[model samples]
Target: MLALQPVDTVAPAFRPEPVTQEEAAAMFRAALGLFGKWELTDDQAATLLDMPVRTYRRWKAEGPGRISRDGCARLSNLMGIHKALRIIFAEARRGYGWIKAGNDAFAGSSALDVMLGGELTDLMRVRRYLDATRGGW
Candidate 1:
């Protein structure tokens, strides 16, 4: 006769709160600031955000409006990547410079280049790379 032991299931400890419109707007504004710090042109920023160039320009000039969930996600990933870079490099300039610097991990392409793939997953990939490099989530 064989006895079967019960398996214990554990729930996740952390659950994120739903993002509010204000929070989304704030993230959009912050992403614009990050673009300036990273010296990303409008086209590059739009590409990274997975938005049309016209929309990006409009948002930049008129202010944050109707940021979709996917757009917020892209902004969040960009912020996460920036934070990881800040933690990894003591100098802020170094962190900014690193975005455009070639890396073997990205197949000799800059992190910005990888992110310019114009997909939400592309932004996430850069964030994941930075997180892994810095030994953080």
Candidate 2:
């Protein structure tokens, strides 16, 4: 006879590591470059960054110094999405254009549209979708 012990079903609490100021600035720069590669307009970039258009412009012009925690998370997610796209699509053009290409998974909405919703989760959703496409999940 064997006795089975109940496994702990509770998930571990998520504790995100503190991002350094320099790291945040670098991520912001990378995210901006990604937006450029995707041919995103200023408005689109602002939306993705989850900031107003004016604030985005100011940050772009002045360069990021100490971005908020949420801003860092958003940029990190954007960079992750970009990396996933690059991995999934062998062609650089395809990877860049995939953001605007309609997807069945998003009810025919483009990944760009989903990401433009200005929420961190929106970026994560698109990244997860691309990751799954590349058999990452």
Candidate 3:
């Protein structure tokens, strides 16, 4: 008869600390120094970025390779608004439920127009309206 071996499982310890700009520069330099030494999985890459599987799929379908935080979020928001507006316009033309849908389509702009004198486009229209009407938010 042969003796059975027991499995040993232990998780690695990690500590988190805020990185200053100088620390960030040095850390990135050190990490980059070990290029092609460590092997990483596709799942590991996605997991490291905290991306959802579905979001990763859509992004990969668009183009291969890594995606940036700001660019991806901005593109996703624009695409969502575009699709919604298309549906709203189609429904409005067919004479269905335009009253509520149209009301808040441009909440910031409409509110700004209501108050008047928002010549500058750089400013947040809703915030500008609030500043003009009330003190400030």
- Which residue pairs clash in candidate 3? none
Off by over 4 Å in 2: 1-16
> Lowest-lDDT window of 10 residues in candidate 2?
64-73
Task: Give one digit per residue, the lDDT tens place, for model 3 in 1-137.
Answer: 99999876776678755444454334333322211122223343234224565654554454433434433332333233223433444553332222113335355344213212312231234334324334333
Candidate 3 lDDT (Cα, 0 to 1):
0.35
Candidate 2 Cα RMSD after full superposition onto the native fold (Å): 6.0
Per-model TM-score versus the true fold = 0.87, 0.85, 0.23
- The local distance difference test score of model 1 is 0.90
Candidates ranked, most accurate by lDDT first: 1, 2, 3
Clashing pairs in 2: none
The lDDT values for all models are 0.90, 0.88, 0.35
Encode model 2's per-residue lDDT on 46-134: one tens digit a residue: 98887889988888999975689898888888888888888888898899998999989999999999999888999889988888888
Candidate 1 residue spans exceeding 4 A from truth: 1-15
Between 2 and 3, whose lDDT is larger?
2
